[model samples]
Target chain A: DAGVTQSPTHLIKTRGQQVTLRCSPKSGHDTVSWYQQALGQGPQFIFQYYEEEERQRGNFPDRFSGHQFPNYSSELNVNALLLGDSALYLCASSFTVQGYQETQYFGPGTRLLVL
Target chain B: AQTVTQSQPEMSVQEAETVTLSCTYDTSESNYYLFWYKQPPSRQMILVIRQEAYKQQNATENRFSVNFQKAAKSFSLKISDSQLGDTAMYFCALKRSSRALNFGKGTSLLVTP
Candidate 1:
């Protein structure tokens, strides 16, 4: 079975520009989550989508948004990109059984660089 | 709010040897989860092992094992008989009851042959 797959392995954008990253969740998974991993730091949760609705969000600002399709594919959108926004964006998916105990499977991630 | 910490930035071990990476976290939730993920040069985040907060026994998978101390909020990973293929950046993460994770800065492990 194919694991989670992300599009555009690497991306480059300029300040004040907007960018979108895509992710396909693992087969048989329903929930999708996005994370940002800065150099020398661990991944931080950005937001999570379940049933095509934004169920929960992290500490990120309104500039970061996401969407989950019926097929469980997800897209992350960043508006007004900043140089600080350059990081490895990871997508994780998990099966929500009985509403608890989540084991997330992660994608390779999309490397974003804002110049 | 929860936070994970990995004090060691980098560590090196000889092939066939054993090494341990340290991690600690702060959380008030009674039930949660902890995980260790390995990111190799390929940059794929692979799940190494996980420990549930309520489980008293540590979680183990093959040569990978964890020493989980719930009271102290400590979760350390031990890799036995390390191999050159074990080189990677290891991250410690915490999943609260709310299901979002808080992660540590990560420790880079290098296995020399």
Candidate 2:
């Protein structure tokens, strides 16, 4: 069984530009969540997608958006990227078993560098 | 809003020895979950162990274990027989029902020979 997989192991974008990172969740998983890990810091949740709709979101601004396809794959889009947007974007997948307390397995993450 | 804190920014331990990392979180929810994730140089987030709020026995996985103090709002991770592979950035996270996980700044652990 394959674990969560992310595309474009690394990406570089300029300021004011937009970028999209892709993720294929683990097999048998339906929920996808995105997180941002800055240098020397832990990951901060961006948002979660369930049933092709955003289920939960963190304090991120509107510029950060995501979508979940029918196949349970996800894409995270960041518009008007700033220098601070440079960080490791991580994707985690989980199967919502009992409503909560599900174990989330993560991907290798896409390193985004906003130049 | 809930907040998780890892006071120790860095920790070191000799190979085959033991080391403890501290964490504390602020939350008002009665039912929730706590987790420890390890991120190595490769940058993959690996779940080390987890604990449910209602459970009192604590959670353990191999050489990794958690000391959960509900009243004190403290969750600390202990790694026994530390090896070089154990070196990584350890993050403490808290998640309430149907909520996103709130993670601490993380503590970097380095195991040396």
Candidate 3:
């Protein structure tokens, strides 16, 4: 069984540009969460999606938004990106809010570099 | 709001030795869960171990165990017979009931051969 998978392992973008990163949740998983990990720091929660709607969000601004499809795959879209937006975007999947271990399995992450 | 903290920025251990990583969290809710996740150079977050707040018995995996002190809100991870492959960034996370996890800054573990 495949774990969570993310597309475009790496990306480069200019300031003010928009980018969309994709993620496919692990098989049998129903919740998807997005996080931003800056260099030398921990992953910060961006938001979480369940049942095709956003269930929770973090400190991120309106420029950062996400969507969950019927299949539980997710897309993180960033608008008006800044140089500080450059970071590793991680996507995690869990069976559900009440699933075993309350553990989240993460993908390899998309490395975004903004210049 | 819940917060997780890892005071150790980096740690190193000789191969075959053991090491402990410290973590603490703050939450208003009494019922919650704590976890340890390992992120290797490949950047995949793997669940190392977890402990439910109500479980007084510490949670343990094969070579990984957690010293969970519920009263103190402390959860530490101990890696035994450490191997070079064990080197990675370890993050302590907290999740209140029905909430998402709040992760710590992460401790980078280096197991030297």
Report the C-alpha lDDT of model 2 over A10-114, residue by residue, as the tens digit. Answer: 999999999999999999999999999999988999999988999999889999999999999999999999999999999999988766627888999999998
**B19-77: candidate 2 lDDT, tens digit per residue:** 99999999899989999999998889999999999999989999999999999999999
Residue A112, candidate 3: Cα error in Å is: 0.3
lDDT score, candidate 2: 0.93
What is model 1's C-alpha RMSD? 1.1
Write candidate 1's Cα lDDT for B72-113 as tens digits: 989999999999999999999999986777889999999999
Clashing pairs in 2: none
Off by over 4 Å in 3: A97-101
Candidate 3 CAPRI level: medium
Encode model 3's per-residue lDDT on A1-115: one tens digit a residue.
Answer: 9989999899999999999999999999899999999998889999999999998998999999999999999999999999999999999998764543246889999999999
Query: Model 2, residue B18: what's the lDDT?
Result: 92
Candidate 3 TM-score for chain A: 0.95
Clashes of each: 0, 0, 0
Chain A TM-scores for all candidates read 0.97, 0.97, 0.95
